[model samples]
Target: MDRIKEKMNSLRVEADESAAKVEDLQKQVKTLEQENLQKEHEITSLTHKNSQLESEVETLEAKVKDLKTAADDGTGHLTQNEALQRRLQLLEEEAEEADKNLRETNDKLRQTDVKAGHFERKVQALEQDRDQWESKYEEMSKKYSTVQKELEDFQAEIGNI
Candidate 1:
């Protein structure tokens, strides 16, 4: 009876150790899950911002093209009005302003694309980092399980002894 009691006590100790290891692993898994969620949200927000900037660039390019067409029309040869020259000068200025706006928009679009790509790379890096953590967790979990099995075997042997 004393031997049986000692065996039971040993089994209890082994069980407690296994429980603690499982709890630690669970905490680590929870932390990794939260980090993954945050990275996904940031990538989504940046993608939406890049899409809006692309639309704005397209609109600005269309407006610039319209201005260029108006300036190139042969109104100087067809009209005898002295104001035709002034109208041409104003149109030229408007076209120049439109050109400036188009270039600025294009630059902004390029920058947004670059930033989006950078964010994408960041996300990939994070995923790789997470993958490494996951592999480590798996390995540790396996080791913990093996230790638990060993404890059970030792407890069984103690009972036989």
Candidate 2:
């Protein structure tokens, strides 16, 4: 009976050790499962962030294309502005030339007016001299007629005596 009790006690101790080892292994398995769940959640978050970044890249590319088109339009506008400035400069020069021509014409007209005024004054003086000469000629003709009549009367007187 004593030997049987000793064998039963030893078997009970071995059984207890085996149960403790199984419990430790179960705890390690549960910790590994928690770590795997955390890793899966991190992978899901990184995938969402990557998708958002790709979408942002596409949007930035579209914005760059629009900016290029706007730049092209601005270049055309600048060219048109340059052409307008050239035309305006030409018009300004033409206007200046016309003004110079007008000034010269005005100067010539002033000279012609002065010459016409001088000629009119000379014509007035000539008309006055012509009237005086005509009056002197009429006086000389009347005196000649009076002298002829006196000569004829003297001849008749001589014949009567």
Candidate 3:
């Protein structure tokens, strides 16, 4: 009777430990799920931003083409000084546009760099979490096997009695 009570107490303790482990695993799963959702949101935002940048680049290309055509067409009709002044104005405008484009491109590049770094860190963190979970699972498996063997030995002893 005392041995049976001991076995019951042991099982109770194992059950409680298992329940706690299951709860902890559930929480880890929830955390990983939240991280996945955040990553999806980031990907969506980056995609939208990439599309906007592509549209802006197309618009800038059109503007450049239009300016070049206008400069070519206007050159033939002007006197030398007028032509020189017009050319200078067009050059100045082109330079300004180029500078503006360069600045915008640099800003976008910096933003992309920042996002990439953030993503890398998140990935590293996730990998660490996965490794920890795997290690815990291995430990749990070993513990379960040990408990099963002990239970079998107890059963055998009880049968002999």
Candidate 4:
């Protein structure tokens, strides 16, 4: 019947639309995954930098302590002691700068974590939607096949008559 053809055409259009949407969702998921991976790498690099800065600060502190001990032990000229004091001041400044950098890196790491979490959730939702659309497309195809078979059988009967 004409009505059956109309319904089949409509089903076909719906199926095609669902397929396109599924593909688009899949692409979005892929892009999000790539972004998430990039964020992870950035996090790792920042962590490494943070560790290095902490180590540097510790080393500088140890050097300052050693220089103080030397100055107090009276094992050098007065000029040598003055030079050591200046050097200590510069080392302390460097340590302070390193501490500041570490704090900034930690903040950046936290922000990256939040962004990664958001992208992961988005990817999961998109995947779920794609799965549902794929299931619908399969069901539509089966129904279309069944209807087409029925139509063929009816035509054969008509031809025989």
Q: Model 1 off-target regions past 4 Å?
A: 1-86, 159-161
The residue pairs in collision within model 2 are: none
List the candidate numbers ranked by TM-score, top first.
Answer: 2, 4, 3, 1
Q: Please give the RMSD to the true structure for each candidate, in Å.
A: 71.1, 6.5, 70.5, 69.2
Runs off by more than 4 Å, candidate 2? 1-35, 120-161
Which regions in candidate 4 have their CA more than 4 angstroms from the true location? 1-76
lDDT values for all models? 0.88, 0.84, 0.93, 0.93
lDDT for position 42 in model 4: 94
Clashing pairs in 3: none
By TM-score, is 1 or 2 better?
2
TM values, all candidates: 0.42, 0.56, 0.42, 0.48
lDDT of 2: 0.84
Candidate 2: 10-residue stretch with minimal lDDT? 136-145
Candidate 2, residues 1-161, lDDT tens digits: the string is: 77778887777777778778778888888888888888888888888988999999999999999988988988888899999999999999999998999999989888988988888888888877777777766676666667667667777777677
lDDT of 1 by residue, 72-147 (tens): 6545544545577788899999999999999999999999999999999999999999999999999999999999
Model 3 — which ten-residue stretch has the worst lDDT? 72-81
What clash count does candidate 3 reach?
0
Give the deviation of candidate 1 from the true structure as CA RMSD.
Answer: 71.1
How many residue pairs clash in all the candidates, one count each? 0, 0, 0, 0
lDDT of 3 by residue, 1-161 (tens): 88989999888898899899999999999999999999999999999999999999999999999988888766654566797899999999999999999999999999999999999999999999999999999999899999999999999999999
